[model samples]
Target: MKSHYKFLGTFLGLLVFNSFTLASFSAWIDPYNVINSRTLPKFNQLKPQSNDDARRFKAINVTRIKPKTIVLGTSRADIGIDPEHPVLSAHAPAYNLSIPAGDMYEAMRYFQHALVNQPDLKQVVLGIDLVAFEHREDVGKLDPEQAARLETTSYVQHLPSLVFSTDTLTSSFSTLTANLKGEPVREYYLSNGRLIRFNPPEMPIEAVFGLHLKSAYFESWYKDFQLSQQQMDAFRTIVETCEQQGIDLKVFISPAHVTQWEALRTSGLWSTFEDWKREVVNITPVWDFSGYNSITTEPLTEEMHNYLESSHYVKEVGDLVLNRVFRHELRTVPNDFGTRITTANVDAHLAKIRADRSKWVRRNADVVQLVEQWSRE
Candidate 1:
C-alpha cells in the first residue's frame, strides 16, 4: 500500500512539472506566431522564415552598434543619412538609428535605452517635426515581449542560454528560409548583389496635403498654437536629461513637399511652428527648410519633383542642415553642463572639416548657404 501511494505521488508530480514546462514554453512560442506565422494581415501568407529571419538578424546586428552619436527620427531621416558616408566621419561615429514611422515619444524611449546601455554614446541628432507631436494610433505601441528580448539585460544575462536554445535556432532557420524566398527584406540584403535598395513608397499628393492641413494648419491654427503644460514639461525633461548625461543634442526640422508647406503656412501652422521653435532651443541653429519654396525660384511643380524624388540629394540636404549648425558656431556647453564635446576631438574634427570643404559644401549646400548668410549677419 505504501509503495503504491509513493508511485502515485511521483506520477502526479511529473504530470504537474510537465504541464508547467509546456505552459511556459507556450508563452514564448505564441508570440513567435505574430512574427513567424503571418497571423497579421500585412504579414499573412508570408512564410514563417520571413519574420523570424529578419528580426533575428536585426538582433544580432543591433548587438554590434556601439555608436558615438545616434541619429533618431522617422523613416525620412533614416533614409536621408547614411552612417558609412565620409561626411559623417568628421563628426563622432554616427549610427542612423531612426526607425520607420518613429515619433518623438519613440525617439525619447530609444535615447533612454541608449543612455542606460551605451556608456560610450556622446551625441544625439533628433529630427523634430510638427507631425512628431501630433497624436497617432501607433505612437506608443511597443511590443512588450520584443522589448524584453532586446533589452540590455537579456544580452548580458541570458545570451548563452538563448544562443543554445533549440527553439531559437529553429526559428532563426525558418526566418532565413523565408528571406531567401524573397519575403520583403528590410535594411540590408546579403545573398543578392551588395546593392543598397531604395524603395520609397509612392506618396499620394492628396494624403500629403490633407495631413499638412490637418496637423500643421488646423491643429496649430484653430485649436490653438499651445502645447499643454504637460507636453512642454516632457520636452523639458528630455532636454534636461540629455544635458545631465553630457550628450551633444542637435534639433532640427525636416523639409516637406512645397505644396504641403504652403498649405501649412496659409493655414497658420507655420507661424505656430516658428513660435514653438523660438522657445525650444534658442541658441542652437534651427534649420527650418520650410521656407525653401521662397528661396528657390524654380517652378513649384518642378521643385516638388526634385524634393520628393531626390534620394541622392537628400544626403546633401542632411549635410547642408548640419553645416548650418556648425558654421553658426552654435557649439556651446549646455547650461546644465553634464557632457562637453572634448576640445581635442573638436579641433581634430575642425581640421577634417577644413580638409573636406568642397565635399562638405556640395553635400550640405542648404546648410552652407545658411552659414554664409549668417556669417554676413
Candidate 2:
C-alpha cells in the first residue's frame, strides 16, 4: 500500500511537468500574438497563418485596438483596401477586417464584435461581393465550428493554445524555424489585416487567364446564382445597425475586369446584378462601380497591368474607389467610372450599362474566343 501511494505521487508529478512543457511550447510559437503580446507584432513581420484561423485570432486584437472605421469584405478588400490611406484615416482611425472567402454572415459577426469593443465607432466601409450574397448549401466544410466560434468566442477561450493544444505546439515550432531560415511564411498577412500576396515578378497574360479560368469565382459567376433573401436580410441588418449606432456607412461594388464583366453579361446575370444594385441603393445610397467603363476596360491584346486577375483589381484601382466614393473626386476614374446610385436613377443606370456593354462587345470581338476557350475548360 505504501509503495502504491509513492508511485501515484510520482505519476502526478510527471503530469504537471508535462503540462508546463506544453504551455512553454505554446508561448514559443505564439504566431497570432494571442498569448504573450499586449499589441500585435510589427505588421510587416507578421505572416499569414491559416487565414480563417488568422481572422478569428485577429478579431480579438482588432477589438482591442478599437479603430473607429472598419473595412469589411472578402480577399478583394483584404489585398486591395489599405486602412492607412489618408482618405480613409481622415474620417477615423481605420482597420481593414477583410478576410478570405468572408461572406456577409461572417462580416456581420466581425462588425458586431468591433461594435462591442469600440463604443466610439464612427464609420464602416463595406466592399460588397455579389457572391457573398449567395446562399451556401455547404457552408461548414472548412472550419466547421467557425460560425459558433466567431459568435461566442472571447480571447480567453483561445488561450488554451498557450498550454494544452497540440495545434499550438506544431504551429509554433514551424513559425519559429521558418523565421530563422527566411522561408516564405504562410503568415503573409500583416497584423493590420492586409494580405500581401506573393506574386511572381512577371505573371504573363496567359497565366493570368489560366488563373481566372481555374478560379471558383469564374465557375460560380458562370452558374448565374441569384442573391438569396437571407443574405439580403443580413446586409440590411448590417446597414440598419450602422445607422442605429450612428456609424457612417459606405458600401461599394468592386470593379471587375472586362473579362469578368463579360462573363456576368454572357451568363445572363447582368439583369440580376442590376437588380442587386437597385435593391442595395434603395436600402441606402451607394457607389456603383460595376459594369464596363473606362476603369473596367482592358486591351484584349496586351498584358493587363491594372488587374491582378479578372476579379481582383490592384491597389491603384482601390485608391480610385476610395477617392471617388469619399472625396467625390475622380482621381484616376474616368468621368464614367462610377455614379451615385439612387432609386430614381438605378433603372436608367442599368439600362446605360446594357447599352455600354453592347458597344463594348462590338469593340472587343476578340474576347469571344477567350470566353469560348474558358467555357470549354
Candidate 3:
C-alpha cells in the first residue's frame, strides 16, 4: 500500500511538471502574439505564422497601438492599403484595421473597438467592397463562434490559450523552428497592421485569376449574391459614429482588376452592384474606383505586380488611391481613376460606367469570353 501511494504521488508531480513546462514554452514563444510576454530575435520575434485567430491578434494590436487614424475594409484593404502613406502619416499615425474577407459588422464593430482605445482618432479611410454586403444565404454566413470571438479579444481574454492549449504549444514549436532556420518571413502583418508578403507569388497571374473565378467566384461569394439590409445598417452606424465624433472620414470603393468587374456582370448581379453604389451614396458620398480605369486595366501578368491577383492591388495603386482621396502633393492619380459620387451624380456615374463597360467588352472580347466560360463552369 505504501509503494502504490508513492507511485501515484510521483505520477501526479510529473504531470504537473509537464503542463507547466509546456505553458511556459508557449508563453515565451508567443506564437500567436496574444501574450507578447517574451519574444527574442532569432527565436520568436518574427512571427512567421499567425492570423488563424486574426480577430484576437488584431484587437490586441489596436488596443496596444492606439492609432489616431485607421484604414478599414475587407482583404482588399488588408493586402492593399498602406497605413504609412505620406498623406496618412502626415495627418496622423494610422493602423490598418481591415480583416481578410471582412464583413460590414466586423468593420463597424472594429471601428468601435478602435474608438474605445483611441478616442482622439482623427481620420478614417474605409474601403467598402461589393461582395461583403452579400446576404450569403446561397453560400453561408460567417461562423457564429468566430464572430463572437471578435467582440471580446484582448490580452487578458487570450491568456488561457496563450498558456495551456496544445495547439498553441505546437505553433510555438513551429515558430521556434522557423526562427532558428533564419527563414525570411514570407507573409506577416506589420506593426501598423498592414500585411506584408516578402515575395511575389510564383503562380502566373492568369492562373491565379482563374482560381479566383472558379474557386472563389463560382464556389462562393458571387453565387446568388444578395445584399443585406442589416449589414447596410451596420455600415450606417460606423458612418454615423464617425460623424458624431468629428472624425474626417473618407469612403471609397476599392479597385479590382477589370476581370473582376467582368465576373460580377457575368454572375448576373450587375444591376444589384449598381444599386449597392446608390445605397452607399444615400448613406454618404463615396469615391467610386471600381469601374474600368487605367489602373484597373493594367495587363494581367506576374511581372506587373500592380495586382496580386484579379482582386487585390499592390502599393503603387494604393498610393494612387491616397493621392486621389487626400489630394496629396505627388498627384500621381490617373485621369479616369476615381470619381466622387453623391446621390445627385450617382445615376449619371452609373450610366458612364456602363458606357465604359461596353467599350471594354468590345475591345477585350477575349477577357469577356473567359469570364463567361468560367461562370458556366
Compared with the true structure, all predictions reach lDDT values of 0.47, 0.71, 0.82
Task: Report lDDT (Cα) of residue 76, candidate 2.
Answer: 81
What RMSD, rounded to one decimal, does every model reach? 12.5, 3.8, 3.3
Output the number of the TM-score-best candidate. 3
Please say which candidate is ahead in TM-score: 1 or 3.
3
Q: For residues 92-172, write the lDDT of model 2, one tens digit per residue.
A: 668888867777877887788788767688988899878777777653233645554555435566566434777667766
Q: Order of candidates by lDDT, top first?
A: 3, 2, 1
Q: 374, model 1: CA deviation in Å?
A: 36
Alpha carbon deviation, residue 4, candidate 2 (Å): 9.1
Off by over 4 Å in 2: 1-29, 33-46, 50-52, 90-93, 138-144, 152-154, 162-164, 184-187, 200-203, 300-304, 328-333
Candidate 3 collision pairs: none
59: Cα error in model 2, Å: 3.1
lDDT of 3: 0.82
Model 2 RMSD in Å is 3.8
Ranking by TM-score: 3, 2, 1
Give the TM-score (vs. native) of candidate 2.
0.84
Error (Å) of candidate 3 at residue 162 is 2.0
